[model samples]
Target: MIDLLKAKKLIFLLVIVISSFLIITGCGRDSGADIQSAEDNSFIMNTLVQMRAHGENAEIAVEESMDRIREIEYLMSRTLEASEVSQINDNPGEFIEISEETQKVIAESLYFAELSSGKFDPSIGPIVDLWGIGTEEARVPSQAEIEEVLEFVDYNNLEIEDNRARVTKEGVKIDLGGIAKGYAADEVREIVKKHDVPSAFINIGGNVLVVGNNVDGSKWRIGIQDPRRGRGNVMAIVESKDQTIVTSGDYERYFEEDGEHYHHIFDPESGYPARTGLLSVTIITDLSLDADALSTIAYVKGLEAGMKFVEDIADVDAMFITEELDVHLSSGLTGIVEITGPDFNLIEGENFAD
Candidate 1:
């Protein structure tokens, strides 16, 4: 009788293991079946825009998404003479009518600006231009030069109403560089959804937005870029479906002069690159636009305050990598984030629960 009972327990354990395996391998999908995907890439928005879809209309959807991205870039680019942002910047103190799309992005930027208490200011164009971090003319601006440009960096000075935006202060410029790519990713996701693509991913300059799971119906794996390493080096990986992942790092756009590095992200108050005790901040959420702006805000807020800020928000999780190579994740991401790099250590008990 005892032998029979032991045999039954062994069989039940086997059944549980097999069931778990089936669930993890994905339900109803042939494990060996090939998942066809169509991909396209274009250099736009000052970075490479890539899209991949796994439906019958994958090619068409990718092409349409690319076109939409270009349209957004054309409309929002601050340097483009015909762009709405440029017009508003060129005509400070004068109201300029912009397209509905431009108005939407500007409105969203203003919302984030208020939410982050102006940490993610849209009116940072003048300071960005003075630093010129990403351009061939990039250089560290003098203290006086930065101060001169910083006087015009207040987001509250910009006004938006009825599809018209105007800068109340002369020399105040609006650059959508901080949040435009996320908005573009959101736009591309809409385009993909309109085409009824079942599984698609839109990557606009590393701001990734997914319409669904991977082609194989598994969770999409996204890598958090290692700030200290070159491109493609990741410190950790996160798995998700139907989420947007964005990273704001000091390493993305910067130039070194006199043994000091100056990155693109600047502190609106100090008129200099934000020294927020963070090397990079990555945000994952349902909205690409929110993730984009929040990543920058978290980085500027520093680690302790930034982690708390992200925890207070609903339906959002973040990974903050400090300059000391310590990784801090939101409570929601404690179990979901897997550290893969040896150089970084995950801070225990640092996650805040949802």
Candidate 2:
């Protein structure tokens, strides 16, 4: 996630997608317009989510959107003992009744799990808790420990039917952190749509979605994070209009122990941080959920395979940042993605598979 407010001495954490704005203005926008924006941030889904809407009822829309996100967090948060996910995990083999929202997220997650050949497994909760990459207790687990957890990390074993979900294996757990934000962002879109907002940007912990254009009618500039450089240092910029930009990267949400860095994104097969040789994978598309799932799937697939995975999908494009700081784009993203960081070489037209 990016820290857009870092320069302001306040870290507005979100995934690495930077909301493009003018630095000269205090709030990072061209603010001479008669139109105004209503923005608010709340801690939900374990991230500081912020939404800015421009319209007559922008305030009401933003407030309602936050409430919607809170509801989602209550239903799906794995850490919450009373959450539906925890209820399912706490009681295996028993179908716990869930809201359609939870069912949709799980169902969508399972679809991606199958599509990525379990690379984006929803039943990877045990492995995630073991590594604790995003937690203060983050550390590398032993081979035996990881092996033991792997037995319970099968997404195929997750069953869902009639607005309920369950796991066949006792130790299996479901964590929607991988994709819940995207679903929430889409929900926010609906909230703004109902209010008929002219334009908006939803930054749910760095998974960004822009509705329409800026107040000044300029395409929103989204900055892609540079892996080598820390947050706030942009690798590239994508001029977007009404689209979702989600990136899964190894840069943040990781811990270093003994010179080995373990990231939050785990490879289900190995039960370890994904060593895909690519620093990050970004998916740009209409739906935030699709972009969210695909970004993780592509990162787990690595550079060559990741590029192919994005290319095969219609109406979707992706950018791959390599370990060598090389920026690779899918055929669809070739001309549109602008390289802003001089250190990064835009390696377009090169055969990645070879």
Judging by TM-score against the true structure, name the best candidate.
2
Instruction: List, residue by residue over 145-228, the lDDT tens digit for candidate 1.
Output: 988888899999899999899999989999998888999888888888888888888777668887787777778777777888
- What would the TM-scores of all predictions be? 0.89, 0.92
lDDT tens digits by residue: candidate 2, 1-354: 222244233343233323422111123354525675698867688877878888888889999999999999999999999999999999999999999999999999999998888989999899999987666577778999999999999998799998989998899988889999999999999999999997888988768898888766777788887777655677688888889999888865776777777788889999989997888888899999998899999999998888777778899988888888888888878789888888888987776544
Whole-model Cα lDDT of every candidate shown, in order: 0.82, 0.83
Candidate 2: list runs displaced more than 4 Å.
Answer: 1-32, 351-354
Candidate 2: residue pairs that collide: 1-14, 1-15, 1-16, 2-15, 14-205, 14-206, 15-205, 15-206
lDDT of 2: 0.83
The predictions' CA RMSDs to the true structure, in order, are 13.1, 3.8
The number of clashing residue pairs in each candidate reads 0, 8
Residue 54 local lDDT, model 2: 86
